[model samples]
Target: MATPEFVLSLREKIGHDPLPLVGVTAIVFRDEKVLIGRRADNGRWQPVSGIVDPGEEPADAVVRECREEAGVTVRATRLALVQQVPRITYANGDQVDYLDLVFRCDWVSGEPHPADGELTEVGFYGLGELTDVAHEHVRKIALAVAEDDPASFVGGR
Candidate 1:
């Protein structure tokens, strides 16, 4: 998707100054594997995630993101984890800090594929097979498979 309208308008006023944003990631599991994707914007091999639109519930945003980015329908089963991202400078020069909401979701329908410009590839992966990703992602995947309750991982990283 294009840069969010709110964000674009905000940038027009404040330039690239870092802003705190909320986002959601999906840990969509099926059979014995979890869904992951390579971001079209950054080539990051990670879980499907997106910035939450203004006034959107985090879980709803995650489900919408899963479909938009990965072409899969998912039912979020639980809030999985919450992670605080340090400031990041996007390649486009927009800077932001993200409060991340990670959700554990069950596969609902459709095969994983790059459904939009936000993703270049999408597939299910076994935990042992995930690599070259941020350690927190790996940790969240492992946690999702092994736990039932939501986890709060306040981080400084």
Candidate 2:
């Protein structure tokens, strides 16, 4: 399968007025290690995430992003958190305020690899050894996973 066109188009469309974008991310853990990817854009570690296509449910987007970014099939088990930031400024000078739906999921199949070119590295990190997480919200998701509170959205600092 090819990389979704929506991902490419959305990058150009960011910063447009009335930009209404929804995205999904996942916190996938096994044996006390959390799956994370080093973003090629920012070089910081973060969970699998991508923009939600039009008409796609956030849960579905989560699973799709997990597969696209990590090359792993996952089943979303629960709604972990909803991160709605009014404005997010990107390194490319494209600002996007998004409604981000985060989910807790279990890896169903496929070896973890950087399927999408956006990720530079991918691996499972122990809770105590995570370092330089890319975004505050990503860190929050990791903390929530460590606490075993799928609903928690607190930072790991």
Candidate 3:
């Protein structure tokens, strides 16, 4: 996994200190199937996600992450969720509490491909048939698919 250069630099100065960060994840749907990518580092399938870069909008970040990670273009249909995750420590010794924004996205174009080094596989799956996804992620997808309102938020309080 290639850690961002800026993040790596910050870790050098403040080793493992929990930095509060923001990120976005896209639940991209095409033909009623949601897209999931197998992470290269963990080999587990999850939605396309990434940290919201400095000065970037969360919606824009999700679109960019989807294109880079899965070689697919998407448009945000709604801001689906906002969750402030407690501190999470990565195997690489980096720590952060992420305010992750989940976006319901509509697929615009392109097929699934591992365009970036982050993912090894990218494919679509039905909501009831997902495997290898984290427990919270399963709920996230289900809520995104079932909910009609744009302001719906799913997170542990």
Clashes of each: 0, 0, 0
Off by over 4 Å in 2: 1-15, 91-93, 142-157
lDDT sort, best first: 1, 3, 2
RMSD in order of candidates: 2.1, 4.4, 1.9
lDDT of 3 at 102: 90
Off by over 4 Å in 1: 155-157
lDDT of 3 by residue, 39-106 (tens): 99888889998998888888999999999999999998888778887788887677899998998898
> The CA-based lDDT of model 2 is what?
0.74
Q: Which order, best to worst by TM-score?
A: 1, 3, 2
Instruction: Report lDDT (CA) for all predictions.
Output: 0.86, 0.74, 0.85
- On a 0 to 100 scale, what is the lDDT of residue 90 in model 2? 59
Comparison by TM-score, 1 against 3, better one: 1
Q: Which one wins on lDDT? A: 1
Highest-scoring model, TM-score: 1
Residue pairs in clash, model 2? none
Error of 3 at 149 (Å): 1.1
C-alpha lDDT of residue 49 in model 2:
82
- Residue 118: error of model 1 in Å? 1.5
Query: Model 2 — which ten-residue stretch has the worst lDDT?
Result: 146-155
